[model samples]
Target: MIDTIIFDLGAVLIDWNPHYMYRTLFTDEQEMKDFLATVCTPDWNEEQDAGRPLREGTDILVAQYPQHEAYIRAFYDRWEEMLGEPFHDTVELFRRLKISGKYKIYALTNWSAETFPVALARYDFLSWFDGIVVSGVEKMRKPAPEFYQILLDRYHVDPQNALFIDDNYRNIVAAEKAGIKSIHFTSAGQLEKELEGLKLL
Candidate 1:
């Protein structure tokens, strides 16, 4: 039987996008897109999530893109602005799951260590997780079998009886390899349907 539920934080439970902060900085949408695509790209951001210091990451980008120094720095300077709001529907579903007393709820997220504390302080629902594994804190990230194993071993969770939810297909595939069932989350409504179908909701 499924006795554990794991949720990915960004995009699944929280709405976070660089556009939320970048749009106000650049008048030309294309310019912002180019900066995000070429400079502070997802891969670069993932480095921070993997435990590289934020300052170091920002400095490297600033040195490489001297012309866009301010923009590069602003990526983290106003990082909290990138956070939109919690997905209320998803949060409600999570709340229901939590109070159901039927499964252990946990979170696994690829977020910077420096900024994660801000999220912890801002969102009360975050405290509801029985446990959380943060990439930055752990210095490891998803799609890597070892990282998922850490969570499984640490929690003594049976991969066969646990379900993982994430917005990233790559992570979903990795979860399957770890022997954990997973949902490639797209929307809260779809998530609810899947859970209900599994007799979880």
Candidate 2:
């Protein structure tokens, strides 16, 4: 039986658009793409999520591209704009699950401390979760095995009794390898079917 549900924040609960922030700040697409490729890559985000200081990351970016130092800072400052609204129906589904009292819901997200509060302020539904595990605060991230182990240990949940949902295939694969049941979320409809298959509802 699935007694707990772990959810990824980005692309699952809230939409993220790298292009949106780029378009908003830079008039030149090539420059924007180049900067993203070199400086704002996933590795940088991961480092930031793993408790690396934002100012240090910003300093590194500034040192790399001296000409766009201010622009880069502004990009980080307004990064929250890149995250769009929450997925429709998912919030309602979460509310339903919360009221059902059949499963414990927790958020396990690869999010930076710098950006998480912005997300929390933007989405009130975030407050509904029983527990929240953010990579920045935890100094760990998904697919690392330790991240899932921390959640399992903290909640006293058996890996077999937990279902982790994430938009990233790698995260789901990692959770599965850790002996936790997982759902690779593509859409609300698909997630609903997966839950039904598990007889969770």
Candidate 3:
């Protein structure tokens, strides 16, 4: 029986999208997309998620792409703008699960440690989790099995009894390899159905 639910914070619970912030920075949609694709790629952002300081990451990129210095600096300087309001449906589910007092709730997210404080301060619901494993603080990011293992080991959680939910397919595959069952999150409505099928809701 699944006694624990591990949540991926970014897409599953919070509305975090770099596009949201960049849209306002660039008047041309194509230009904004190209800038994100070429300059501040997901791979580059992942480094910060893997414990590289935002300043260091931005500095490295700024040095390499000196022409795009302002854009690079905006990444860290206005990081909070990348985040949006919480997904109320998901938050509702989370609160309901917590109220049940039957399952253990935990969070595992690939968020930059430097910018995480802003989220912590902004969202009161974040404190609801029994524990939260942040990749930036741990120096590892998911789809890394070691990242999942850290949560399992630290919490004394049995992978077989845990259900991991993430928006990324790669992370879900890694979780399954680590012995935890996982769901690829699409929407709160879908998640609600999955939990119902599992008899968790």
Candidate 4:
């Protein structure tokens, strides 16, 4: 039986997309795509998500690609603009789970500690979680077993009794390997069915 629901913040609950912010920065869509692919790629952003200071990460890129310095700085300078409104379907599920008061609710996300404050300030529902394990705070990102262990050890949550929900296949695989049951999130409606099957909803 599942006693806890562990959630991933970004795609699962919050609607976050870098393209929304970048589209406004560049007049040409192709140029924006090129910048995202070559300059500010997901891999580059992951380094910051792994606990590297945003300033250091952005500065390095600014120095390396002097021509794109302004663009590089805009990544963090206009960081808040990248975030979208919460997914209402998921938020409703989260609220229902919280209101049920039968299970512990937690979150595990690969978000930078530096920028998390903004999220905290913006999202009132974030306080609903009993706990949240942030990769940037732990200096370890997912697909790494130690990160899952840290959550288990800290919360004393038995992996077998907890359900981890994430959009990333690799992270879901890692969570399963750590002995936790996981759901590869596609949409909130799909998640509802999964939870219903588990008798959690």
For residue 109, what is the lDDT in candidate 1? 90
C-alpha lDDT score of every prediction, in listed order? 0.95, 0.85, 0.94, 0.93
TM-scores for all candidates? 0.99, 0.93, 0.98, 0.98
lDDT for each residue of candidate 4 in 8-110, tens digit (9 for 90 to 100) = 9999999989899999989999999999999999999999989999999999999889999999999999999999999999999999999999889999999
True-structure lDDT of candidate 3: 0.94
Model 2: per-residue Cα lDDT at residue 58? 85
Per-residue error for 148 in candidate 1, Å, reads: 0.8
Q: What would the TM-score be for candidate 3 when compared with the true structure?
A: 0.98
Cα error of candidate 4 at position 89, Å: 0.4
Tell me the lDDT of candidate 1: 0.95
Candidate 1 vs 2: which has more lDDT: 1
Q: Which stretches of model 4 miss by more than 4 angstroms? A: none
lDDT of 1 by residue, 87-173 (tens): 999999999999999999989899888899999998999999999999999898888898898889899999999999999999999
**Model 3, backbone clash pairs (residues 3+ apart or across chains), number:** 0
**Alpha-carbon RMSD, candidate 1:** 0.7
Candidate 2 segments exceeding 4 Å error: 28-31
Model number with the top TM-score? 1
lDDT of 3 at 87: 96
Error of 2 at 173 (Å): 1.4
Q: What is the lDDT of residue 177 in candidate 1?
A: 93
